[model samples]
Target: MHSRSRDLVEHAVTKVPAVTLGFWIIKIACTTLGETGGDWVTMSLNLGYLIGSLIFLAAFLVLVSAQIRARKFQSTLYWATIVATTTLGTTLADFCDRSLGVGYPGGVAIVFALLVASLAIWYRVEGTVSVESVVSARVEWFYWVTILFSQTLGTALGDWVAGEDRGGLGLGYETSAAIFGAGLVIIGLLWLWPRVSRTALFWSAFVLTRPLGATLGDFFDKPIAQGGLEFSRFYASGILVAFIAGCLLLIPQRAARRAARD
Candidate 1:
């Protein structure tokens, strides 16, 4: 029993990349791909939002299950799961906002509430929301659930701030991207300041990056009349995927060190 327990613990070590510059770069790229890829299936392919959501949700489930079953961090698997969540998030948000007639503000509120609830439940159950503590299956589940919610929330936020229709802010894609990018800069500065929680900052920045990527993706793929570059969603998704592949090959990634437990 003792030997088995030790082995289990050892195998449960962090199965995610160490938080680093490379991680952020690839994360942004993946989120951008999520937006463009989701659009390709739903709009370009004429599948519609509901179908797109179902397809991406299936991918998210499969990838997340694989992630949970893995014994150690596989960069490819981790990133594939992330991309799945983002793609699912994009279509899911669209369904909620447009299909359900909730509008962007309502969709944002719902997803944001879900995200907050997930974090609260995670902290209540695990006593911490730090990614460093994701050394067990239960904690890993919490982490991924929170990520999915946050990703969905980001899509709603991006649409609320940038969508030309649906009573959005009228900022257009590029300006919205710039604003979210500036928010990330502020978060970075806060990270350097003392008396601030690094974990909180990390999650905050993580959430912000999604919307930034979403807006940038829209800027690239939406029509010129819609204040976008009018590029093909398929081509945009392919380029972003190539960029992500290059980053994964060239940049270093390793599972984060396990945090000491009390």
Candidate 2:
């Protein structure tokens, strides 16, 4: 029975989305929520970045632990954990940048290093750094670690690019988002060019989307002169969370269906 259960688990593992358009959409939404929601707690609610990071980090630990224990890939749980990680990443990045006085560039540099290191370690441990191998707990840990680092890095990079001449780039938030969006378009063309490595293209787009969403979130939450909609971060976050949950529920994705299609 144990052997049979293990086989079932492995079968289910091979049946996830392979980073399609819908996948990117939901991922961007989650990242945007991460940005605004984290800011709502840390800045609007006046919780302080350190305390906010601790709180979100605790939530991430709990959700990821549950994800590890599940017998099958429960979509809701998996995506919920993703959302949790993004939120935690936002707070952690803010803690490093604002609270610790590292500034955006410094935070981006440190987190970029961490993201690269996480990928190196993942490749070393897993032999292949494919998202398809996320069945095992070890690879899953590596995946989430990489994700956390990327999300945090995205926040820092977005801030760095969007601010005034204070940062190196000096692009406004909307302009930064446009530039990143254009980059993603180039990546999409490369991915479809039939010459580029699919694996490389996939990871590149995944990382780029995080920062794209980060800049969009900033545009939604920042002041008018700064080129933002000036929406309440709390309201924006709530709307994004609802949208994500609704999409997950209505997406008609099933492991069995995905397995058959693959």
Candidate 3:
């Protein structure tokens, strides 16, 4: 009884935001920013994927460290770290697919494997992979690592589904976005079933959001000839940043709750 009470208390100290509509809204916006912002650095500024990856990786490291050290959640810092991961994932995925000649299919395979491995290791070490269980530093480490792989995998999947006939099915960006959108809707329906596992649904939704944002981002920045609006990557990124900041101000974030009892 004592141990159970103590566990409940610790769970209340979660550092991540509660999974809510506002959370998903901000997350999608951030992922879109990741795509456009990453492209701006890697393509528009001609920095190349390797350089862009390194820059975002550095920022992720610094921000994650600060995040782990924080006694409680800081909305701005937390969201910034998420953006760092998305940007790093963007360039890193590109580096693997284009620079290393892995191709879109290979990049997706490699990153998916890493994501599964990260989750497996986390479940093994922590005995549970619940976000509400992330009150400890060790769990936080696993959480971030899993997110990194998932984000990278998302970029690869998006590119694979939307790329030209050379590597993908040649589906346009709009089609790819619609596909991922449907996936999210399916997951939402599953959530309504009492027999379904919430943890599984949560992760599925999380991963799908990335690809949805990726395709949307591509649609915003690619040339009109290629089915995009041809908007400036810099301009799109700025708009996304403003949208996220505004949402943060409008909706207060709260730490996630413990997963429902098994």
Candidate 4:
């Protein structure tokens, strides 16, 4: 029984997922889905930003609660929670930027600060912000918080860059995607460079990937005149969600510590 219990705990401590090409692919998919998903509820359904925020917020809270309470990582539940956060982050960011009139720059600043603070507090309490140690509930909470902020920031940055008329950097979605893709390449190189901080590189790439997905998502869903594919937000989100679900099903989900086990 003792050995069995230990095995269960070991399973719980297993790493979420390695920062690999596959991880980035799924993450960007989720982020793009987030953009379209949020817009569907807020714009298509005409629930309005406020109502949409409340709906997604509630879903986030519930799913997060379930995620935290689980004894071990369950792929279905975990990814569902991730989808919840991204969708909620999209609506929340949109609310702050448009309804509250914070604008893209203002929203970016606020969300960036929040992400930094969450990381600081996480490191102070947990002694490290590395994804490899996401076993304890406290560290897991910090992880989710940081993710929430990053997702929100990505929304603001995406909007800021992919607009030619909105005082954005005047880069079209394709250009913005390329720029962020280049940034990811740089970070990957740095990760392989001698004496570079792997942790720092990991976080940098993680945060950057969010905006990458956001921009591409907007590009696909926005109007053709605006250079997007003019896809329905709901349809785009649905397809992405289905894809993510398939990956989770086939990818063999495990805890954060599994890789560390000898």
Candidate 5:
């Protein structure tokens, strides 16, 4: 690569936050907030899934553009974009599962396939799917697209596990959340194994956290009849937002450093 081109790549690498414990903490909180905020707009406000998806999608596009234009990783901008994708994912999955009559299983299958396809293409084009390799606009676009698909798939999978009827597993919200949380723990343990791939483990854990957050969000907002606490969606979203803000303030976050060779 030319010197200028290499410099651009190095600059792009700094656009994303480093993967750390604090990153995961805020991610879970944001995903949970996505659930409540999505529900607030779709269910509480009577906007329905289709309309809710449109609104969040627009927000996602705006934030993503801003993120791409930024010179370095801005925690607020990056997290805001993440929240947008998750919220959009929530309503988009619900629309596919309910409005389109695909059912939870079908929605999960479709979105999962899309996620796989996106990653496959990304790898074929860029030669790597590691987050550390996201050092260009093209790679960044692939990263965000894959994330959107994973988030959508997670919402459907979470609903499938939590539902008591219509081909679901009959697990309540709390149980579903626990199951996903346990899955994440298993993935974390696997990361410690010498033969395991860190990139694979990272994506696995990333996908798992979404549904864990989804079920946990449902636990807070669903009705007692549905085995949830029945808290108001607006209040739940507010609390989660506050929690995320606090974590951002208390925890240190920095951009991932580029390797010696770009």
Candidate 6:
């Protein structure tokens, strides 16, 4: 009876997709697309970061609300929400780091604090910050907020470490991408070690993927003179969107199970 009840609860409540390679592939692509798409609106269209942030922020609000109201895990809705968070993150980060003149380091610090605070509060209230613990509306709210913070932090951190100074560390995008990619590899390896907490590894990888995507996005869209390919932002974003769509069609995903809550 207990097992049956547990199964029912798990099936009914877990709205997040199970962690899988396909999920990460799409996630990285979405993050890259976010950077390029956000740039397209803000730079290519001359809308500026403030205006871009407002537009993407509105989309995030609408999509996340729908995601929370959903009764079952819908892959399309979930991925859509993820993309919204990424785009919003990009614009919001740029607004803070450049427009506000806080610099990327300061922007990263602020967002990192917020991200940690969100996770801490969620852990305090829910007793777990695991994705599987995203079992209620409140938890879902916390989950999204944390995700948004992490995404924002990634953008700022990427710029701080790699972006050519609008205010950056001057590491260069290619080197920055390599560094972040290596970090992901280490996190992935640690995830296999039972002694290491998967939650920490998961969050680490999640944060790292953003910088990787950010650098990759810049590499694709920035001018060749600056060590980038100089592809048009819109063109790059369209390609990323098609790639994400293809992956969604080919890959399989389902709600996370209770057995391995990582």
Model 2 stretches with alpha carbons more than 4 Å out: 1-16, 165-168, 255-262
The models' CA-based lDDT, in order, is 0.90, 0.79, 0.90, 0.79, 0.88, 0.89
With a 3 Å backbone cut-off (N, CA, C), the pairs that clash in candidate 3 are: none
TM-score of each: 0.94, 0.89, 0.96, 0.89, 0.94, 0.95
The best candidate in terms of TM-score = 3
Q: Rank the candidates by TM-score, best first.
A: 3, 6, 1, 5, 4, 2
Candidate 4 Cα misplacement greater than 4 A, ranges = 1-12, 258-262
Better of 3 and 5 by lDDT: 3
| Tens digit of per-residue lDDT, candidate 5, span 143-178 | 898989988888888989998655678888888988
Model 4: per-residue Cα lDDT over 137-173, one tens digit each: 7777888888788788777777777765435677889
Name the candidate that leads on lDDT: 1
- Evaluate model 1: give its TM-score: 0.94
lDDT of 3 at 136: 79
Candidate 1 C-alpha lDDT tens digits along 31-94: 9999999999999999999999999889988988889899989999999999999999999999
> Clashes in model 6: which pairs?
none
- What digit string (tens of lDDT, one per residue) describes model 6 on residues 200-245? 7888888889989999999999999898999999999999999998
Least accurate stretch of 10 residues (summed lDDT) in model 1? Answer: 5-14
Model 1 CA deviation exceeding 4 Å by range: 1-12
lDDT of 3 by residue, 1-262 (tens): 9999977776575889998889989999988999999999999999999999999999999999999999998899999999999999999999999999989998999999999999899988878887878887898889998888888888888999999843777798999999999999999899889899787888888888998999999999999999999999999999999999999999989878665433
* Consecutive 10-residue window with the lowest summed lDDT within model 4: 253-262
Which ten contiguous residues of candidate 6 have the minimum total lDDT?
Answer: 253-262
Off by over 4 Å in 3: 1-11, 260-262
